[model samples]
Target: MPLPDIKPGRLSACQYADNFSDAHPPLTHVQALIEAERCYYCFDAPCINACPTGIDIPSFIRRISEDNLRGAAKAILEANVFGGMCARVCPTEVLCEQACVRNTNEDKPVEIGLLQRHATDAYFGSPGAPMFKRAESTGKRVAVVGAGPAGLSCAHRAAMLGHEVTLFESRTKPGGLNEYGLASYKTVDGFAQKEIEWLLSVGGIEIRYGQSLGQQVVLNGLQAQYDAVFLGIGLGGVNALGLASETAPGVGNAIEFIAGLRQAGDYATVPVGRRVVVIGGGMTAVDAAVQSRKLGAQEVTIVYRRDQPRMPASNYEQEWAQHNGVTIRTWSVLKALDTTLGHVQGATFAEVHDINGRLEMTGKHWELAADNVLKAIGQTLLLADPTATTLALRSGRIAVDDEGRTSWEKVWAGGDCSFGGRDLTVEAVEHGKIAAYSIDRALGFARHDTASKRTRPTPA
Candidate 1:
């Protein structure tokens, strides 16, 4: 049966299987051991410092060398409960691997990402051990909106602190972007859900699916009912290309396209165009274009409004998309769409150049025959009701103090919706963790109880 939205691809189902499988498989025990031994084990490991969650790299790798995988996982999860997912998506080349001492000598760094995955997998595969025990009931409750990396981290840490937690997710399935926005190739075998399940297993965290912050539930109600509220609702609205003909058939947002693929049980039925064109210079664009090619699109092209160096996607990821047979055209801006039968058939583009630091078309124009076009430009923040709260805003994002507290007291915000933070999952996790600690401290100080931070280790 043909899917109404998708065109048949050239590859067989088996080929799709190979292409969509995990981008980097976890290291085997021997491989992990060999790689762990390569670590110079610097007293102050730069890899650990590079990590956003700050997991003790040298300590965890040392435990792995000793074949104590559980200990290593505990160390990792202690810092970042979402290390497993981070291992799959983090740009190690820009983060940990780049800081490895070996990179200075041989240009080949220790496989830190794979090593982290191995440790986390070992613990996940084994029987449950109480890595964290819930604190005594604090008679406090926290409400978290959105079940993405940041929301889950905040909820879990809050629960561990003995505060009841309720996570409201707008999506039917929890695990926000992890369950939706990520590339299927990076997250195989439905690992996103598995991580969600593991995180919820910590207890005292209740999840309400299909519950949105502003629709089913209101932010003010949560603030009134719960002792504190954390908002981690990620960017909900896809940024429009400002180009005409966006609503035509065969046109979609890259985030939505990936989300559909992420939720689909069968990739073959996911509609892909024969000639797909993606517009953007970010990871979403690369993901959308590469997945299009993997789904058997004969020709997939990514058009960016700026040069390749200006692309937000990492160089490693850009090269990976190219290797996957996705053509990348930079310094080009989409002008308009050519449609037939009410569906997009091609697109016109203009050569773009910087004029006085502003982008301007140079009048050079061309058109590509595109059966479909995905807009991966980016996303925008959608507040249920902006006027309902006193939340400060900087450039349309929720402005927060250093502690992740918004202008509204007892209400905190983090993740992509909050200003002054990276949108990466790891950074989101950090934001949530920091916010959790801030909330915990505020509550702690009120009761005249001085406990260590909710997530991080006690200071010297």
Candidate 2:
């Protein structure tokens, strides 16, 4: 049977709006003070240690306690130019708040993300003052590819050093995945573009839309013309499910699906499914499944080949999905698709078990009556120009040294496409920031080896 007229429901709209609304609303004056007071303000705060950007967490919170919002905002933006977005998207329960000293004694840790958002929002409400300004022009130009978190961070930092930055983005707009890849509800209120506008307001940065890294733009020409180059090109390709699947009406990639939903001004018109099966166990899978259920899917299930412990979605995310009525099925892999009348009708799965460190699909299989199937297994790295360049690789990613310097000198890569990308926007911002510092020092504008300065132990 072919499913018809599946779209977001009114109840789903209500629930999605609630779940995806700004994760942390700006704290009220009293709320910020109370949260700041909870902080011990330790000499060496573990919360700072836990953050990838290493924002002076304690100092900012103390400033908030003192009602110095502008100072707090400056402290944050100094370390992370995208502090507002990070405050909205970062997994605070696992990072900063997890390391709070109060967490050891009291179950409730200070609301660090909220406090940070409160401070940063206050600054963005009026960005004309420009919390930080650039040094004198260095007469050096950098070509930054991709305007995502990493590219934007690198571009902003490079601009701060008085270096000219021309950012190339493939899409019509900026914000990369933050604008397109994220769940729409998480970034409601057009905050992603708003933050990007604010970040660029610092000056020294120029963006050219519809210019891709390799397809439309040439890398060699960029390398020859620019004084330095930062490749924050994110993963552009979506991984296949490896099934003999058809390009039917109901088969889709979770990333593109989520991107469509995020970009849609009218969520009610977005097509959904009556019964949707999302394959994989990562955050993407959970998000797709939960969102499908919210989008009027009568039955939504997540199928993963591995056990729950090996699932990539964090416990908080998994729980959030389950709380929203998403069913999780482990130890199963999508085997084949069932289609009818130019539309997807269902899918087949094989039972799998990890034996001798390898996943094996047993002979046993089952059928699922899914009107739509989404593949959320993972993403693939589409090198903008795969044939022309010979970029080194570490574990199937662009190999980079400590400073995000790729094997090809003068061609630095960061963000998801680069090796060691944790696939989080916050981590990507850190990558771009570090790469900017490294590029600055390499240009002889800075004194020290920026790459050698360790913020934390090398991540394994």
Candidate 3:
């Protein structure tokens, strides 16, 4: 067995700088104006229906067209507190843009995502007073665990409704997945932190960093201290490759790699293998593979157990990976790792087939040469002590009702850690928003008569 050839400075300084730049550059004012005019501003827009956060897509675009940048930003942020971040990271091509009416006449839809970024960036660039103000103090306090989209959304909304919010975060900096899990290129220039600061400007919300749920703070303690508790602690456990090389020197979780890349002061200081192999088919896999290539990996491959259509990553993301020179090998299940001297050199996989809707290995085996292997199969929720709380679970996720009320009273959950929703940032924001509304009602805040008017299908 030999040691892996993993080290920093795989790419030159200039290459590293270019490779890690923003994946989607913000549109110039003129470009944004032209794109905004492309929107028809339909009275009954399907794009709004497609948005997970129910952002008034047409209204925002209309404002953009009218050069009402601040108003457009307000429209978007009023619905989704994380509008700017989502505009950069969301798979709008499959969601809002896919449902756009313009897709009927022209194959392409309006650039809703870019338009969104234009509006939000304009507002954030030249910030004014906070868009929304907190209500009079209600003398009620809430504890929000996790600083990801869901928790932040919940905290912001609850605070706006006059509840004091103490947001608990495990890491030194906030923005859980947005800050750590996403590819560095997707959120270039420290946008996640900027968005967090913007959201916090509404006031009445306090963040306690270096505080994790299972460790520094416990569920029981939070319940006793706060009038209500909202858990947005996203999946904290990474799925293993279940192979002997899982802990090999060159083998690591893709999330950790991305987080390191995000936190790296200099991109050239981050180590990347010349040949990298990533397992799984979700956004994490694509992100790791693409970033690996950008980090100067000569050959990068993403191996998925199922076919392309079944991939958790959207078609746009898959295409983006391929465009960036990432090889996509589907119908392959990881079987073993070829290791030497406690380091991963490559991986062995068995070609699989769908038989009666169940994946079965066909006994056909192959290998991909690699100096690094990233496990991006999935993530799991790691509760500090399940017995410490009586919250019910569904398929290992916290089970909550439509409004995010958990089995335990005075407790709510949302985001990836909760049941019944996709792991998209926008979906998590909606969950947090709805959960806050529910919590507000429980705490004697008058419910809007139109609260029942909004509806969205629960994500399975």
Candidate 4:
């Protein structure tokens, strides 16, 4: 009854600064050169294949070694418009760095992610002519829904190919997860918006904030006005514990908590519990638990149903949470919430066993005392909305072809909202890029020959 012990100023200003400061600092000029020289510049770079966007890793690193940060960043942004954000948030340990030829026991990886940040930071710090140049106007218009990474990537690509793009975003600011869902320490100094500004400098694209799909912006209206439509509206439904009536004060979703923390004016003003228990094992779960600790939570535990190796969060992320004093309680699923006076008091977890890839709950259960319990199980596509009835779905998401063509010929979907998506920011950027090129081809605008023109064609 004492308001659940959630209060502001849990930590001093100095503690807040140190806790939320940049998780990975940028490389100095000499350090960038030293690291860049580590790359062998393979003729067939495995890092490029491992990358979702297929960035020219060797070329960029070579440019970095030559002290051409501008050229290096141009090479990166050409492939991925969100190069800076991806450099910070992407799990290089499992992706590019893992594929590095130099990632041997004898020698460490070339620090590709940091070198990338070095190049992008240099370009962003010193403004110059836009890296991207728009092609001749095709006079075709495209509608891009969601201003997150996928939507922004699609809009930027479509615009660069000379198609007018109208991007619709539900939130006040763009960058979707990059701006709202990412951990604060990862992307410090408002870098998300800075990258977006550089991406927009390519021209021929307009962003309409507060315009969400299935609401202010509808597919039927978009289809009628635009030659093609791209939907990157990410998953909107957060999964919950099977236990019903678990809703109570001091209990909430981890994504919501993260968004609040990202937007908070000051970390000291953010409310946190003395004890926090996070549900799930993916990136969001770790982010929630770790950030809770940073917010001065005395104790934080991550409750996951699966074993440690089976956790969706990368090894680096799990180690990060553990290093920050968060206890990883594996093979435990939330059975129920212990509430007092309509507020959460603690949680009950049932031990689970993996029997041939299936989680079987054991008869035994245990309890953990906590005031804040955050749900980070997973996210589901927003199909409950009546507006999405016309869209055919697969595996609980919007179905799309290799080129991002949806069931509707004129409509293309990508990012977390579509099936076959890897749920990685880099992969989402690839989806948008592929969809834009496909849309351009359908519009009869040849990339090589702008003189050719034909009406939008129906899918074969």
Candidate 5:
């Protein structure tokens, strides 16, 4: 393909080491304590309402103020088991932090995400015991597909409720996006695997790796074999740009590229171009652009068809990318890729204007030099055979009710593969938790457990 521009070893060892350090380093003990004091702990806290998992924000902050790290972790985890990972990746500036009452009075919200991270990190660092005890065995078996946030969360909650869980994962490791899709800087120090290991310490959950849906695992067989089946099978396919040159050698999926970077032993081993262009308007695009810069790419540009307000990524994420030297070109659409011998060399883009409320491209077009291109456009759900599965689907994903129950009996689904999924880690965790209780009820198990009182998913 003659792609010489994309090469590894672009930076020195020190530069590589510095580039991948924790994107947001942990708060010091004093910093966390001080941040905890900033909270008013209102009785009707808006922050709690903003949390997708409905975590008790004021109560957790109160626990932190009392110097009870474990207690604080408990309050957070009872609602969201993946609190550690969420604290690292969740869009807090728009969610909980934005909803803080202090934002109204002082224009500064208490650092809830950082405080939660502070407590969760301490507990995970020396998590000797699981917080919740397993109830008497219910003899109910749950087959959870996809070991990403949703499936793993479902598995842990089911196990905690005294049900045996077989977690089916397509890849060798668990923590789907956490392990494979998240930016390296956002989750440094192998935190994804560490969180998963601590979650598995609860017992009664077995993970079957390399077990992909429709390949090694099938829905019909799972329904017959298990008491309840929870499908967290995340979006397996990356959406493609319809342009012809998108197939060039230098072009790639942003998620796949990020996954390779995440799995690589050393940052220097991953190849990056001197000038790279990414196409999309979401967190995946932002991650790809920022990581490309960190990997020593001289120039990185993110081109989105829509303007700033319509971007799926939070305003904080957009600013983060810009801070990392990424050029965000809004109202721009990718026109074509310039290729040399089947290898990408550059891209052409068109500026669009909202005419009659529709984005119609202007006649002028411009080109940017590049050797690498990434498409973070979005993802798609892949069912083994769309016709073979009787489960109802909506908007190209499995349809589910509030409890995550699908139309099919003995089956529930959540995560990005399900309709109404917010594509946020916290929301996915809540989906698993709610579905676990629903599964518990469907199995005719005793409903005297404390988790029955857990809150439902809410708007961010």
Candidate 6:
């Protein structure tokens, strides 16, 4: 039994810089113009219908075609405040671009995501006043918990509607998963922080960091003081692999590893094993495996219990991992970890098959050598004593209506912590936006005509 060989400086400085560079570079002006023109601008665009945030796809593309970059950005930002980040991280291949009409005649769908990045990046790169201004103060205060996409989106919308907002974030910085969970290559050059600063520019929104629910702030206190409360506290609990060797030194949560890589100032100093094994099929698993390879891991493997089609991550993401020299082994369920001196040396997995409609494990088993194992099965809601809030839970998540209203009055929830919809960032933004409007109506404020005018299309 010996300690696992895990240390930093595995990759050279130049390799680190190259490995972590932006995954998709922004398009030039000429390139954007050419791409925008490719859009047929269908009368009833299916692309818009497919988007979770319901951005006006054809209209924005038309604006870009006309050289109206500001208007295009306004169209995108007004629909989803975090459109820029979504453009970078969202799986447009299966969402918007999948529904694109051009995909029929031309195998290539219009680069809607790249065009979006072009427009939004243009606006943020230029010197101009903020897109929206705060309305006359309503004198009513609102307390928002969580600084992730949902919370930030809610805070921005509430502030724009003339409510004073106190955004409470448990973490030291805002942006929630955007700041912490994403792969370093997807969001480069601290874009998450930059977007946060831009979002806070609308005024009337004050951020209080290090304020977590149940500890520094409580639901009862917020209810008593603020006019309303919105909870976007995203899932904070990681699901375990349920193996005895999970406690091995080389085994860790994939989310924690991604967060550590995101926060590291020196990429070369971030320790990574020579051979890494990630277990799960979601984007988090793919991200961890790909980034491990980028960090100079000689071999990286993603083992998913189910078949590839059943994986939560899109096909595009799966292919991206394969292209990055990571291996995908499906229909394999982790059985146990082979550890040496409290360090993971390898993992044993059992073959799985779908019998009728049920998944059953076969007696056949195999093992793969690995110095590190990452568990990315899923995340669970981290509530601070559920009884204290008295909000009804459905399947271990906060139950909310179409308007993002919880069972309890004056308290609302959205994002991954709430039931309904996919856990995509764009979907979370829509939840926050809808919840803010609902909160406004509950407070008896005259609904801003713009709010109704910019309504999102119902999810299909």
Error of 4 at 443 (Å): 0.4
Which digits, one per residue and each the tens of the lDDT, describe model 2 over residues 1-460? 5454355553556665665566435778898898899988898899997888889999999999998899999999888888998887888888898998898889888899999999988877866566778889999999999999999999999998899999999999999888988776567799899999888988999999999877778777788889888888888788887666647778899988888878888666678888888988887887688777666677888998988887888788888778878888989888888775567788888998999989898889998887778889888778767433687877767888778888776888888888884688888888898889999988997743545654323545
What candidate 1 gets wrong by more than 4 Å, as runs, is: 1-10, 386-389, 445-460
Assess every candidate by TM-score: 0.94, 0.94, 0.97, 0.95, 0.96, 0.97
- Against the unseen true structure, what C-alpha lDDT does each candidate score? 0.85, 0.83, 0.90, 0.88, 0.89, 0.90
Q: What tens-digit string does per-residue lDDT give for candidate 1 at 1-460?
A: 2222456555788998898988887898999999999998898788887887888898999999999999999989988999889989998888899999999988899999999999998887773767788888888889999899889988988888788998998888888888888999898877888888888888999989889777889877888988999999999988997867889888899998998988888887887888999999899999999989889898999999999988989999899999989999988999889765578888999998998889998989999988889999889888876434566887788887766788887998888888876588887887788788778888873431211222222111
lDDT of 4 by residue, 1-460 (tens): 4668777798889999999999889899999999998899998899987788878999999999999889999899888888999999899988899999887743578798999999999999995876778999999999999998889999999999999999998899988999999999999988888889888888999989898777787888898999999999999999977766457878889999999999998898889999999999999999999999999999999999988998999999999999999999989888889885678888988898989989898888999988899999999988544555878998888988777888987899889998885688987887888888889988997563211221122221
Q: What TM-score quantifies how close candidate 5 is to the native fold?
A: 0.96
- Give, for candidate 4, the lowest lDDT window spanning 10 residues: 449-458
Q: How should the candidates be ordered by TM-score, best one leading?
A: 3, 6, 5, 4, 1, 2
* After superposition, candidate 4 runs with Cα above 4 Å error: 105-107, 384-387, 448-460
TM-score between model 4 and native:
0.95
lDDT of 6 by residue, 11-118 (tens): 889999999999889899999999999999998899997888889989999999999999999999999999999999989998999999899999999999999999
Where does candidate 2 clash, by residue pair? 20-185
Residue 405, model 4, lDDT: 87
Please tell me which model should have the higher lDDT, number 1 or number 6: 6
User: lDDT by residue for model 3 over 53-154, one digit each (tens)?
Assistant: 889999999899899999999999999999999999999988899999889999889999999999999999997866898889999999999999999999
Please estimate how well model 1 matches the true structure, expressed as its whole-model Cα lDDT: 0.85
